[model samples]
Target: MADKIRVLLAEDEPSLAFIIKESLETRDFLVSIYGDGEEALAGYRKDSPQILILDVMMPKKDGFTLAKEIRLSDRNTPIIFLTAKSQTSDVVEGFQHGGNDYLKKPFSMEELIVRVHALLNRLELPVNHKEGIAIGQYVFNYTRQSLKFNEEEEQLTHREAEVLLHLYKSRNEVVDKSVLLKELWGDDDFFSGRSLDVFITKLRKKLTKDDKVLIVNSRGYGYKLLC
Candidate 1:
């Protein structure tokens, strides 16, 4: 068998932590569990893992602080935050602290596995000219949060950039509305649904400069960006 994917899971809730650790281990992942951020950070310093799964509300040190510390030493390792906090500011802070993805409480094991695989797939990709994505004629530099078109440049807001990146990743495939809502906004409530609609509309207008770009809505399904 291939070497297992190393995961540093920092979660204070013992029951939930055990559940997550066991689930990942069942899938052949090598999980190093920690009950607090301080211990997790110490473990991180000793042996950096391929991925980090952190709970936001932890003792000794919060996940955000630990993430900042990790970011200072490594920028490419994928970090996925698991939290119960659903506030927009909290989610924004997670990303600002170098989180690659976020999963709210009550998420299924299947969803967790899917997200972990997706992050790993992204990490395994080669560092080449194709590192970023192109939406129609607009060049989206994910790392820089900038979009350029015909010598004109526009900076995307955090939400806008995240939505665009997810759309680009799905490419020609239909991205389910629920998936978009959950992945980007961390919820599928009515307000989040409306917010997603607005962002999609804005992205469509931004890419309208190129006639080849189209963000097609699927009614009951989701949206697709075809170039």
Candidate 2:
């Protein structure tokens, strides 16, 4: 039989952690819980979980630090940060530090489960590209989550890759902001809308090497990727 999908979860709150573990277990996932970032790091090295869910605030080390450290050696494993931070800058930091996705505190178990399945499905899917799609002077490798421009390359988080792929599919046309939020984030609430803006800002910076590439905002409506 196939091995159960392993999940390494690090969160200090026992009640929340328990709920997450129990929920994932019900779906046939094997979850190992750690109460601190340091412990989680050690556990990750020893057990090699297929995915990681880390709380942003934990003893010994924070989620951003843990993610950055893990990324020094491992880049493919998906990471989802659980944050209570409300600031947009905090979310940006999480993404910059190698987190592929995030869940705000008080998130639904169903949503968490769905995100888990989505990330795992991405890992299991067949290779997306051998050559990659061209966007202006850049080559986007969806499977690798990378965008290359000449000698430089921008490594994208899972969320960023997914966002870029959606825009790429409908390049030069306006893709409604609400559609992006609903499709990628499961809702178009205020928080989700702000998060989407943050991602677009990051993507724009990465593609700045070529002036021909632009992710244009459509005046409170949507965005158009002109390349």
Candidate 3:
């Protein structure tokens, strides 16, 4: 039989971690759960896992600090940040520090499974492969966090790059406001919805440099990238 995908989960909440661990196990994933960041990091060093699921707040080391530390040594392992803090700044910080995905608290097990698979699918791509998504005449390089148009290049903040990339991926389709809020801020609450609006406005301003590119709003529904 094929070996199960090994997962290291670091969540301070015992019950939550237990639930997550059991769910992953039922999916045929081998999971090791830890209640603190320090112990989780230690566990990581002891037995390297295919992926890491970390909570932002923990008793010892925080997830951001832990992810930063791990990035210094191992840059390839996918790290998913789990947190209740759904602020835009917090989300950006997680990506800047090497998080591949973020999930807000009170998330469903099904969503967790989908995210895990999505990340693992990316990892399955050829080594050293980088995707530069095209937006009008501009090419957005996600790995370098840069957007290029002709000879000019704009370096995007981690959050900006992520938001733009997602919109570009859903080009011509209305990406629900809640989707962006949940995917980026990790929540679809009122505050996150407001933050999503700010991000969309910011992206619109930046992409306005290209006449053919427009981020269209769907009134009460969502936003779409029309190129």
Which is better, 2 or 3, measured by TM-score? 2
- Model 1 TM-score, 2 decimals: 0.66
**Each candidate structure's count of clashing pairs:** 0, 0, 0
Sort by lDDT, best first: 2, 3, 1
Off by over 4 Å in 2: 124-126, 157-159, 208-214
lDDT of each: 0.82, 0.88, 0.82
Candidate 1 displacement at residue 17 in angstroms: 2.8
Q: Write the per-residue lDDT of candidate 3 for residues 62-180, one digit (tens) a residue.
A: 99999999977776687899989967789778877888778888899999988888767655533332576678888887666678888898877556766777787778999988877
lDDT of 1 by residue, 1-227 (tens): 79998999999889988998899999999999999999999998877699999999999999999999887767667788998998877876887787877888989988888889877765453344235566777888765567899799886655576788778878888999999887665469886787678778888888888988888988779999898
Looking at model 2, report the run of 10 residues with the lowest lDDT sum.
122-131
lDDT of 2 by residue, 40-75 (tens): 999999999999999999999999999999989887
Clashing pairs in 3: none
